[model samples]
Target: MKIKHLTRALILGALLSITGAMSSCEKQTQTQAQAQDGQYVKKGEGALSNVMLATIQSAAYTPTLPTKATIIESPSNVLSPRTENDNQNQINAAITNLSNSGGGTVLLGSGIFRIKSPIILKSNVRLKGGGQDVSIIKRDESWTNVEGRGMLESGGYIEDLTISDLSIDGNRPESYRMSNQFPLFGIEITIDNGGTTRNNRVYITNVKIVNTGMGCHIKHTNNVILKGNYIVGNGTLASSTHSLPTFFHNVYLRSIDKAWVYGTNYFKDSPGGNGLNITHLTNLTVEDNIMTGNNFRGIRLGGSSSIILVRGNTVSSNTDFGIGLAYDETGQPQNFSIIDNTVNNNDNNGIYIPNNTKNGEVQGNSLSGNSPLNIKKGTNLTNVSCQAN
Candidate 1:
């Protein structure tokens, strides 16, 4: 019958050419997961110059966040001159005599304690110190750039606070800004009427914050727990001079609802902003942290943040964008979970999921030479369910 119908039309044209090449490779992987619009490729933008970007544009403090978190609502700590010494009047009279004889623990000894101010804290209290390199709290080279809030500072709506070990030396930043406060951090939990106030169960352990402008600013905190701490924040003599650059940070959570930055060690990085700049957060959990060499961005979950979880981190060589779901002070930006990270060689773009970021989940990351390891500008109505990154 005509050679058996020419062998059934050559096996139906090789099964319709393998179903149109597997549906054109699933529509070219959903158009490369939304990457278009010139695929956001600008490789690198580091080693800031231009006089370090004009000392970060001579800080008109244009929204690189931070500093709405004021202190001095007077739960304690605000004896102004930034806390006039005698080690801040014997640690604010031992944390107001163990929080009015209700709470306890204020033991702090073992050398150097020349504080220039801020050691006020209350609510349950428990500011133990001894060895995080022998309890040193230096900071009083005639305290310049000193406004107030941190070197250990606090305000209203307090909770069961606990700051252990200790080794703060925020000997930097604020090289200016006075009257309108904001320029100081080394554990500054806030309040003083800048609105939003929660402040609950805060616990920071094995502390060791150095050269600071910011090394912890837990604002509007709630169930916060930054364990195994050891921030460097911005060194190199305040990032080669001024540019408190994008408002300093080695940790600057804001409007936080729940947090747990585990195994922290954002050391030797942050020439200024971001090494963990979290904002308007919710159920956050940044585990196994070790955010590396930053100049800006080594883990910055933006304002409209959602159920976030950046796991097994080691966001390397930051020059910006190693882990950024950034952009927003409100709305969009949802369930993120950049997993098994080791976002390597970041000169830029190891992970930069922007564009209406929705149900995100970039998996098993161990990306290499990140001038571009992943930059999914989400669509398909903000999917972002990528795999084996």
Candidate 2:
């Protein structure tokens, strides 16, 4: 009886030990899981949570965020003899000084500066005016021969500046008379300087380019925004050279990325000359713009790839089709979208989509006041959506 009792005691002890071990292992597993859950929650909140919380707390107590505007210094009053213009030296000096000080705004007081040469803008330098009409940069006809006299040619990084309320007259009155001389119109604003990887930006707003050649010539640029400007090409020149005409649609934009032309007006006549002509570009957006009195189509695209969005624009009184999509030398427009545009009173078809064009979407545009709703030339056209008259 004593031996059996001992055996029973031993068995009971072993069972108790096993249960204790299992319980301890389970407890350890649960603790490790709890620790991992806590770590995940902390990591999910991110490292900036403390800073964001502090900022919110401060904002709740403060009335407004502190802010201030910096006013740039002006150069000494000096005049340039070549252009017979006041503030030419001052303007150059001010721009240089602004560039040296990282970046700042260079204000042009109310006056006309007869610029004989093109002004080079530095990185972060803003050449601004009091208003578009008040501050004018008139072109000196004699100085047009200078190497770089094409109004404002920007190669540096420019941002947050207004180059508007100014006038650029190419002053070539003699070349306007020849009908065959279609290339004499000079460029108002030329960008990129044909440099590689020059990411320059410009805001040309509330200005007028009258009786001059190409309004704003953008070449080899990226992220250019042309807005709220009036470009009228109605001048008669005596002899036409290789230069584009005053109203010639020579807004040359080649090899550009992510460009936008919005809320502006262009009047011109020709195949390459229109309100907006994009070539060899990717990711273009032409929105809320008005192209009237154009001799050719309003918007023309050639040699462009990727999705080009044309929305909320007005194209009227054009002698040719409202929109023309022609393939490049190789005959391919990879993808395009034309939506919600108001095209009316055009002499030819409202929208011309050729046979070589592929992967285009045309929808929700008003074409009743014009000709046929959609015109397709080739077999490769796909994903086209339109409401006919």
Candidate 3:
């Protein structure tokens, strides 16, 4: 009986020893993780406020403009779908007249309008549609010379313009299926500062853009807001024309500053191109966006961008990285913060920052299902803290 009791006590002692060892190991591991937190510096100091202030200072300030006055009605006297000639001239003429008379709304009532020529938007002009579902701006096949250019083009220091509640179909399947050489862009805003005008305060909202060579090309512009818009690159059409898919982008921006893009859906059917491609930007905020099913990175930042805050975004189901931060041809990205984002199911890393990147913070992100690595970093990556869930 004494032998049996001694053996039971020995077993209990061994179990206690094992438990104590596990507890000590756990405490040691936690201390190491806590110590690592102090290694990197946090970025995005006053980033949100700075972006907002810059937008307020530079934007066209059209809050007091009347909602329903001085209108240029569409079906545009001479340019309806049933008309024999394309309505490009009529549309431009109306826009020119409105701009000359200060500024007003060009109301697209209903139905699809075939635009054979580029619609150049002028200062303080608002191009509004009845609704996204009703008003369609389709590319005109009859205009062969203008095939690869943007259907609606803004340039020459244009400002105080708003494009809202419209659907632009690039007709990629019909246009590119037979010919891979066609250059198609949905909306392109180019800033030429040589003129006295500065392309500032451009507001785009509730716009549905699909099946284009690229969705919206915003280059060399400032104080731009792209909100509540649907920018899609349907893989079916892109795959139909094999070569074009390689160059497609849902929304591409270059040399833009004080831009706010939020509440937007970038729906890519296949791994075709990036959902948002930004380069050489400043004071940019991308929040509350849904980017999924993209072939490339969902959001890419490069070319020496600063004060960029990417927060509360769902970047998932992409064929490549969910968020890609790297160096461009000119320079490296800096002063960025990626926080509170849900990144998942990407083919590569959920968030990829090459060691060459500088001055960024990656914190409070819920990441999973990224193959190989959830967060892939490069050398010389500084001031960045990645707290994994």
Using TM-score as the measure, which candidate wins?
A: 3
What's the residue-level lDDT of 139 in candidate 3?
71
RMSD (CA, Å), candidate 2 to true, equals: 19.9
RMSD of each: 17.8, 19.9, 11.4
Q: Please, what is the whole-model Cα lDDT of each candidate in the order they appear?
A: 0.65, 0.55, 0.68
Candidate 1 residue-wise lDDT, 1-389, digit = tens: 98667656754654454344323311111211122233332335321111111000111111211112112222333222223445867777868876787766777777667776677887787777776978678788776656545778885678887878768877664442211233567778877566555777788789888776677887776778777878875522232244344356778787877787777555548665678888788778787888888776788888776777777888888887888877664764577777777777777677787666667666556677777544535444355555434
27-131, model 2: which lDDT tens digit per residue? 111111112211232434533221211000010111111111232444323332334564355677777777777767676667677765667655556566666
By lDDT, who's the top model here? 3
Residue 15 local lDDT, model 1: 47
Clashing pairs in 3: 148-183, 271-295, 355-378, 355-379
- Please report how far candidate 3 places residue 140 from its true position, in Å: 2.2
Q: What TM-score, computed on C-alpha atoms, does each candidate reach?
A: 0.35, 0.67, 0.75
lDDT of 3 by residue, 1-389 (tens): 99668757755654454344323311111111121321321334322211111000111111121122123332223234435436566677767877888777777768787777777877777888877878888877666664447878884667778888889887665545334355577888886665234467788889888877677887877788888988887322233344343455788887876888887555554326688888888888888999888777789887888788888899998888998786867887777778778988889888888866767666556777887677777766566555323
Q: Which stretches of candidate 2 lie over 4 Å from their true place?
A: 1-83, 144-149, 155-162, 174-195, 234-250, 264-272, 369-377
For candidate 3, the TM-score is 0.75
For candidate 1, what is the TM-score? 0.35
